[model samples]
Target: MIIFVYDNSFEGLLTAIYEAYYTDIKPRAIVSDEYYEPNLIDNRIYIESDITKSNKVYEAIKKKISQDALRHVYHVFLSELKEAPTVIYKYLLIAFRMGYQVDFLLTNQHVLNMHKISKKVSREKHRMLGLTRFQLIKEDFYYAPIEPDYHIIGLLAPHFANRMADQHWMIHDVKRGAAAVYDKKEWFLTEVDMKLQASVGAEEELYQELWKTYFKSISISERRNPKLQKNFMPTRYWKFLTEKKQS
Candidate 1:
């Protein structure tokens, strides 16, 4: 078996795909060097990320396939699944051959797997949009921390950049040690320390209390359903929710 290994960057993965397409031997797997495990039986090739080659693959996907297909490929990459590289490679091979019609190939396992994983990442992004809770750390600065299952901090940046155009804010993905920081004009993603320290002021503390109180006051005790609540607001996300915090 032959495997293509690349640096974990999206461009690197694209470069690996480009190399795979040109090579006489089709690779059985494409993986990041970070997660690669050596095997004596398997032939491994390390792919250097070339922006020119990566961009060629990127433009080809956009022009040959549909723009939506390009989006699916990116979303699947953000899933951070170990098999994501191989899945993307297979999906793109079918996409290049089938053109836009690849989306209609629901029965195809590779196509279906790509759609499922992409949808999962998209769903989490949607959930984070509503569920993210921000605390005012200082004057005009807000910070929100999330621990999503997928690498979605970058996906969430544009939404908040538009919504909070006038305020400096940050959305930190604690689980991944990465953050999307907005400086009132634009946003950028960067690596952050796992142990981020931000002090909540007295006003923010009071606001948290009021918000938690409002949450409880609006709920009808007699009709309250923990199961239903958990369905909407998963227990996994309660750690960052102001209303869900223990008062």
Candidate 2:
């Protein structure tokens, strides 16, 4: 049994496929850097990430699978689910064995599992965009912090740009050390260090006060139930939700 290992990145996964096929050996397992076993007795191959090889695999997938199928697979890859990588690999293994019909993903149990996981991930990405509340800063740049479980920075960038087109703003994914900045006509993604906004001093506290007041006024104490609030606005997420934190 041959075991192939590569870096734990999407590009690395694709490049590993290129090496796997080139070696013309059936791989017993495809493992990532995070799961490398030090004491391996099998015929193990270590693969480096190569953009060219990754591109070739992408091209092959596109040729065999429909564009929509590829997108679904990418979404599943981005789901941040613990089993996503393995499930995607199984889907690919089956796709290679069966020719170009990735739509069978709709029916295959393993593929279907990925579809569900991906959908959940995408839903969370969209929800965070709606829930994120930005504070207008001194530089006229709107900013917000989110610690999403997935790499959703690229996905949530568009909503703010479209809704507040005339404003300069940024939606930072603090967990990922990245942000999407938008001007009226253009947007760019940037990487920044993980640090709190240095300028958010006593003045920034005003927004917290206002948000807390608004939350209290809106809350119908007669009908308020902690259980209901917990269901939608989880306590785990309250740290970044200024209003929730204030209340």
Model 2 lDDT, residue 31, Cα = 77
Candidate 2 per-residue lDDT over residues 103-170, each given as its tens digit: 56477887677667777778877778766878775445567778777777667777777888998766
My TM-score estimates for the predictions, one after another, are 0.86, 0.73
TM-score of 2: 0.73
lDDT of 2 at 153: 68
- Candidate 1 displacement at residue 102 in angstroms: 0.2
RMSD to true structure for each model, in Å: 10.8, 10.9
Model 1 TM-score, all chains together:
0.86
Off by over 4 Å in 1: 197-228
Best by lDDT: 1
lDDT of 1 at 74: 92
